[model samples]
Target: MYQFPKGFLWGAATSAPQSEGAALKDGKSPTTWDKWFEMEPELFYDQVGPENTSNTYELYKEDVANMKAMNLNSFRTSIAWSRLLPDGKNLNPKAVAFYRDYFQELVDNGVEPIINLFHFDMPWWLMEKGGWEARESVDHFAYYASVAFEQFGDIVKKWATFNEPLVHIECGYYGDAHWPKVHDFKRAIQVGYHTLLAHAKAVAAFRESKYNDGQISIILNLSPVYPRSQEPADLEAAKWADHIYIRSFLDCAVKGDFADEFVALLKEADLAPVTEAGDREIFLNNTVDFVGCNYYQPMRVQAPEVAKRPISDPHDLFAPYDWPEKRINPHRGWEIYPRGIYDIAMRLKESYDNIPWYISENGMGVSEEERFENLDGIIEDDYRIEFIEDHLAELHRAIEAGSPCFGYHLWTFADCWSWLNAYKNRYGYYRVDIKDGFKRTPKQSSFWMADVIAKNGFSREQI
Candidate 1:
């Protein structure tokens, strides 16, 4: 039996825009995502936008009931900044009332609500003012965070300042997967620095607030970097990849400073972000109480091929290589390396002092949903069940080796709108039928997960 500790948090996570439908209702303003969808509908799958998602805004109570039915002891959801503070300054009373009622409903259903301040839904007005690239935007976010803490701190014992900050930096700034898609390395670095600053400022605000007893953290999607070969060049390539992708934010959040070598390399390349006076102290003084890590896959790096012409794109510096022999999830196009979770846990334990981390997001997203339907009219997702089991077995191994992991939250509770991909890929225990009046149907994996949560673990026979 792979038994987890007693009271280990068993829950699922969902973001506001991904699940909540009411985009412009109750004094809500448009986020950058809302504006992006309007500007380029074709960028989304089948032109599906976030205007009408799973209707969680109006059906949160029913969702909480579903959570309770699944035996979930905790649920992680983000507060829509556009909903709470439409202008990014004033609080919307209607939105405030809605969140109070919604969070209370989760608590009423015996599910601990884990609140996150930002989940890639920046206010359009704030984006117009340059978003995270501008230092002033950091102050704006800190003010918004302070309001959230003052308002919801009593009910919510766990708060995350930002969910996947590097995702916004990489996708929105470096890649084109998210809103405000800009492809500039310098801008990406500036935005990343400002984001880390905003997190630190929020941590400082939370510490000074009257409701400072609760734990606060930042959720990072930490993927370990691995060399594709034992060659020195491949190992060096992997080191660079880890420095740029993992240590860039992890060091700043945990150690309260950027790695000197990393900073020096960026400076040498004229890509270092501009730092203001006293910003160093802000980060140094307010390290997170804990860290929320979301592991999906390991990164395979190899030495770059020499080219006659100069390489201009900064993304090519790390030289990310795909191993043809690596195990892969055909549907989602992600590498399937369950051992990466244990590697990440060990890294946290040895490097970050094992400061009470948890798996905030881990799950399988698959295509071809129709093929999974069974004779009982449910999604018999045995693949997803096996995926979770394998990952949990690795996680159990890490915990047994003295990793301070207290919880595990799957990527989502239900199939909802994903950014860019929209509803093309579904990653949920409960499947939501978008065409059928947004119906929620529990998949086979949901029942399996319910049993796992009830037993506090799983045995080989159960699998």
Candidate 2:
């Protein structure tokens, strides 16, 4: 058995909106997600509306109890922006009191709290005003972050400014998949830049706050970038994909500069991310204390003859309607190349000084046939166990190679709510019966994770 260092973090993650159903209560304003559910209910699977979620707002005690049962020594969850500041400006007293109590429960249970500020939840008020694309939203976001830190910083010390910023930029701005469904690359690029700026500003704000043990970070969903072959053109395309997809924000946030090659690429394409006065310095100087990486899969790229294209540019080189090249896992339809985790880890170690870091998320999604067949008990999750073990094995390699790795936290503890999938693509350890008043039950993989965390390593031969 491979042993993890003492005091490693072992737990699961969830967010307020995904788990807490009382969406319209707690003085919460409509988030962009809430609005999405209402405006285009068809976009959601089965048109599952968002009125009632996991109800964590009313069930923190039971959730915490679930954590204890999981043998979790640590837990990660995001605070809903609209919940605390209903209109995205003023603080609601009950909201603050509720979260304070929620966080305190974790502390009381010896569960280390890793609090993320934003997890793809945007206040509808902000979106109505053009969301992150407009400069005003940046300032408004800074204010909202400051408010969150001011109100909750006392109990929640470990904080993340944003979760998977690129996904938001890609899904929200450049693609019509996520909310605000605006498909403008220029807006996407600008919003991407501003998101980084917002992260830096939030980090600065958190530093200024008087929270004990306060640490600020940004969570990136990093996939290992791969070239299909050693051909020169293929390698070039691979590097380009890696730069725009992974390195851009990471270099700026962790290493204090945009990658020179990516910057040159941007310049050559006449697509340098527009920067405001002092934005570069804010990013350069306000490096995050840690990196929270959400590793899922890797990108396998082959050079295509799309010449007028800026590879990795949000602008579609392929027709806007066509999907790009990547191996899709037939089982779940996600690109399931496992080496991405290793490559992502090594990239961070090689380029970003290997800052203290943790794996914030890594999980697999499966069709709901198992659920319909009444086959989703904790014991039947071997595929998930295998998926996690594969990534962790790579992480073990990175750690041995001297990456400043801390620990790992799976995407969720028990079956919690996903944003668009509603209760469909359940990524939880303890499965929550969505119809049973959000009742919780452990999947077999959850118990496997407990053993994995307890033992720290699994081998290929073991399979």
Candidate 3:
């Protein structure tokens, strides 16, 4: 049996924008998601919008009860900036009260709440001010972080500054998948830089707050970059991709600066974001106490095909190379590379001084899960169990190989709504029936997960 270390945090995660359904209620301002849905309802799957999420805003107590029942010792979720500060400045009394009671409930149930400050649900007012592209957004974010720490920092010991911040840069700025949809690489770089600066400022705030010893992190959705071949160009392309996507934020948050090669690349392309003289000091002085790694897929790339490259575009440095033998989750169209977890841990150990980290988010999303419901009215999600087990096996290998991994958290706790995708892909041990009052019901995997938590290890024979 492969045993997890003592006090391993067995947990699950969900974001406020994805799980909480009250979009524009109780003095809450509209987020970019709510406004986007209002502008283009057709863009979302089944025309579902942020207002129709898991209704956790109203059903949070039940959610906590479910977590306790599932043997979850910890839960990671984000506080909606719009909810906490409706106008992005003043605190909302009702919102503060709601979060306090909710977090207290989690603690009362023995589930430590790992709260994050941002999860891409930018308040529309902030987006109107150019969002992360504006330097002022960094100050506003720092203020918001300070307020959060002052309010609930005592109850929520573990805090994250941002969740998958690269997604905001890539999807919102470089692609049209998210809010403020624009296809400008220069804008993406600025947004990414500003976001990192905000994270550093938040870390600084956490240090000054009374809960200085409490853990603070930035949850990065990291992907291992693979080359198409062992050729010099392919290897160089892969390394460049890694620097841009993974190391850019990883190094800044963990090691306190961007790689020299990455900075050179930015300067050569004339794509560097504007920065103040003291920004470097802010980053260096406010490095995070830990890291939260969200691994789902790997990036396979080769050198760009054309001889000439566009100076404005970052993608000009590399070209995507789809692996023919890659196993994929057909439901979500993501590569199922379990070994990437081990690879990521080893890289962190060797390259980044082995910072204490956790599998902040890792789970399989399946479509039409109700089709697998058995006669007992429970979804027989043995496939989800198998997916988690495979990943956990690789995590065990990483732990044994001297990786400083302390915990593992699945992507979600309940079948919550995804932005744009809505409820298309369900990733929860407890199936939340959206049609039937958002009822929560445990699937087969929940029982299996409970047993794993109880034992702290599992053998293949159990399966």
Best by lDDT: 3
Give a tens-digit lDDT track for model 2, residues 151-224.
Answer: 88888878888988999898988787788787776677788888888888888877777773678888888776
Q: What is the per-residue lDDT of model 1 for residues 299-376, given as tens digits with 9 covering 90 to 100?
A: 888887851112344445557788898888899999999999999999999999888998999988998676889887
Candidate 3 stretches with Cα past 4 Å from truth are: 307-310
TM-score of 2: 0.92
lDDT of 2 at 51: 75
The Cα local distance difference test for each model comes to: 0.89, 0.77, 0.92
Q: Output the TM-score of candidate 1.
A: 0.97
**How big is the positional error of residue 240 in model 3, measured in Å on the Cα after superposition?**
0.6
Looking at model 2, which ten-residue stretch has the lowest summed lDDT?
A: 314-323
Q: Which ten residues in a row have the lowest lDDT in candidate 3?
A: 306-315
Candidate 1 lDDT score relative to the true structure: 0.89
Model 2 residue 201 lDDT?
Answer: 83
Cα error of candidate 1 at position 250, Å: 0.7
